[model samples]
Target chain A: MGKYVSVRGWLECDESTINEVKKIRNDFTATYNEGLLGEDKLELYQSGWTFPEKQINWTAYVFYGADIREYHLDFMKKQLSEMANIQDITGYFLIDDHDGDYHLCWQIYENKFIESEQENIVFNK
Target chain B: MGKYVSVRGWLECDESTINEVKKIRNDFTATYNEGLLGEDKLELYQSGWTFPEKQINWTAYVFYGADIREYHLDFMKKQLSEMANIQDITGYFLIDDHDGDYHLCWQIYENKFIESEQENIVFNK
Candidate 1:
């Protein structure tokens, strides 16, 4: 009921990648399966469209009632990039406990994750 | 522990609306003030840039462990549109109960909330 990570981003995909994208989403939707991750849950949304940008965007939140799912973002990025059609994963994931002003902004990947120095710039709160 | 709604969209803002936008977010941030909202939780995220689009995007999730916050989206849209510089809420909100495939797609505003037929379109999952 406390810790959570926010995922806000989009995948650059083309016609060849659409089915794979949906398949990946079906995999993520498995988070709703009973007893999979305990109280941990993920509410994922895909909004916007390809008419304007030709890419679909995703907005999601991963909940950790008591334990943060370690390397969850890494797993997500890996899955997203492993697809043949996903050109890129653009955007960041913010780890927030709602108890501090500073939070981890996961945006860069250089063998591992890097913190984005944009909590105060790209966001207002 | 089950029901959740996802929010993903951006506000058309200028210099005049920035402060007010931050103030509204501050008010929403008060949801973490100890005992507010009971077990209900909200994880809100702001991302993207104003350089290429001149607008920032927000992705959020509102959890209703046992009770759905009725009229929550209505109140949100009202609050978002009541501001001066914020232009429009261009995206829709989807409500999935995790028990059915037919969920509510709320996007249209014609006096009351209208359902958006975008569960399959705009989204692959």
Candidate 2:
């Protein structure tokens, strides 16, 4: 039995906005020496995009390994809420391995509404 | 001056091959408690693809933060050479924040021939 997980989310923001947020978060982490949202996490990569010519904004991915639970999800939501100037969160995809198969869960946030669902999403070669 | 670096490489292999290689590498790490190729590294994610119907194979991305140098690149080449049945490395992308801007480099391996080049690859929001 092995455990591996990943989360991907896309955000709508400009380069300057993204850089500002990242700088703030990085400084906070350095000063506090604690993980974001009180959870041990590390950003893998954050990349900007230019698709449809001014339709899509920036996209970023973060990776962390810990017991996945409801508390962590709640914490993530609260932290995002506190951060200003962030909107239009398309959705979030969670991938975890359980019982020899990958399990996927999605949460979409639109118009201040949120919805959750589960599906079978596997990444195999 | 902040130093952040990332490397992206795509490999074309089958799912079973990817899983087998991952398991071997994981077990090796656990048993020996040493990084692959004598370098401290960690695999971020390995995902398969289905496109063009049996033409494209699996792809994987591994992330590790260390001082990027010639020795590490040489080590990576040697390790990949040792791994059998792995081929069709479309290319490898290197991104680093140098001089307050992002620098990009590319390497393509095809037909057993490798080419190196550089370009401006920025991921802005």
Candidate 3:
């Protein structure tokens, strides 16, 4: 099998965004059939939604044990980004990889997907 | 050596908070001398600040090749969270580990650091 990657992020928790994420969660992932999406191309765990009401409307979502081939992980991220408008979305995409486990961070600023320096956490097993 | 963990996160970008992070980064890491902090215990890379103006004042940050022994990584995280008031901070700690690279996400909501599901990105190598 291929190597594994972990994911975690935060977004504004609104009714529409929450519902859109819920739809994706339902549409993706396999129960007993073949694949979660179309064929049997990938397998991963996407966490449910939660409200923090921490100064801002926050919903912490997660996708663990993600398959990193053909940008499948990236595709899932794209789907989530579309859940709400850019103004309603102020989040980042932090993907860590090999050699030295360096983190590549991407964030939304003025409706553009910008890659810059930010902060995140990680634990190795 | 131990396995590697990747990190990427986002928070509000402010002059004071940015200055705090800049200080911590300076205090840690070994450029040429001995260890970063006090002794030769850990080796890590923490990224700098960036303003995205992405609807909200956003700063995407990162930590790569972090040392996890003796909770050094955890300590660094604690320091960063203290830079600003709870209302000015909103971030998630998505740590990835072995067996399947599962992500453990923790966030700050309502002035309390909460461990819940969130969204982020990861790429395996």
CA RMSD of each candidate after superposition:
17.3, 14.9, 17.9
Estimate, for each residue in B8-120, the C-alpha lDDT of model 3 and write its tens digit. Answer: 34443344554554555555543424333443343323321222211111232322223143334465456555533434554555555544454656554444555544344
Best candidate, TM-score = 3
Better of 1 and 3 by TM-score: 3
Candidate 1 regions exceeding 4 Å error are A31-85, A93-97, A108-124, B1-125
lDDT of 2 at B17: 50
Stretches > 4 Å off in candidate 2: A1-125, B1-4, B20-71, B81-91, B95-97, B100-108, B111-115
Measured with C-alpha atoms, the lDDT of residue A48 in candidate 3 is 20
| Candidate 2 chain B, poorest ten consecutive residues by summed lDDT | B48-57
DockQ of each: 0.03, 0.03, 0.04
How far residue B51's Cα lies from its native spot in candidate 1, in Å, is 23
Better model by lDDT: candidate 1 vs candidate 2: 1
Q: Provide the clash count, candidate 2.
A: 4
| Residue range A1-125, candidate 3, lDDT tens digits | 43434343444334445555556555554342333244434332332222322211123232222324333555555555554343444444555544435365655434455554435443321
Which of the two, 1 or 2, has more TM-score?
Answer: 1
How close is every model to the real structure, measured as TM-score? 0.33, 0.31, 0.36
The positional error of residue A83 in candidate 3, measured at the CA in angstroms, is: 3.1
Compared with the real two-chain complex, what DockQ does model 1 have? Answer: 0.03
The sequence of per-residue lDDT tens digits that candidate 1 reaches over residues A2-48 is 34344433332344445556666656555434443332233322221
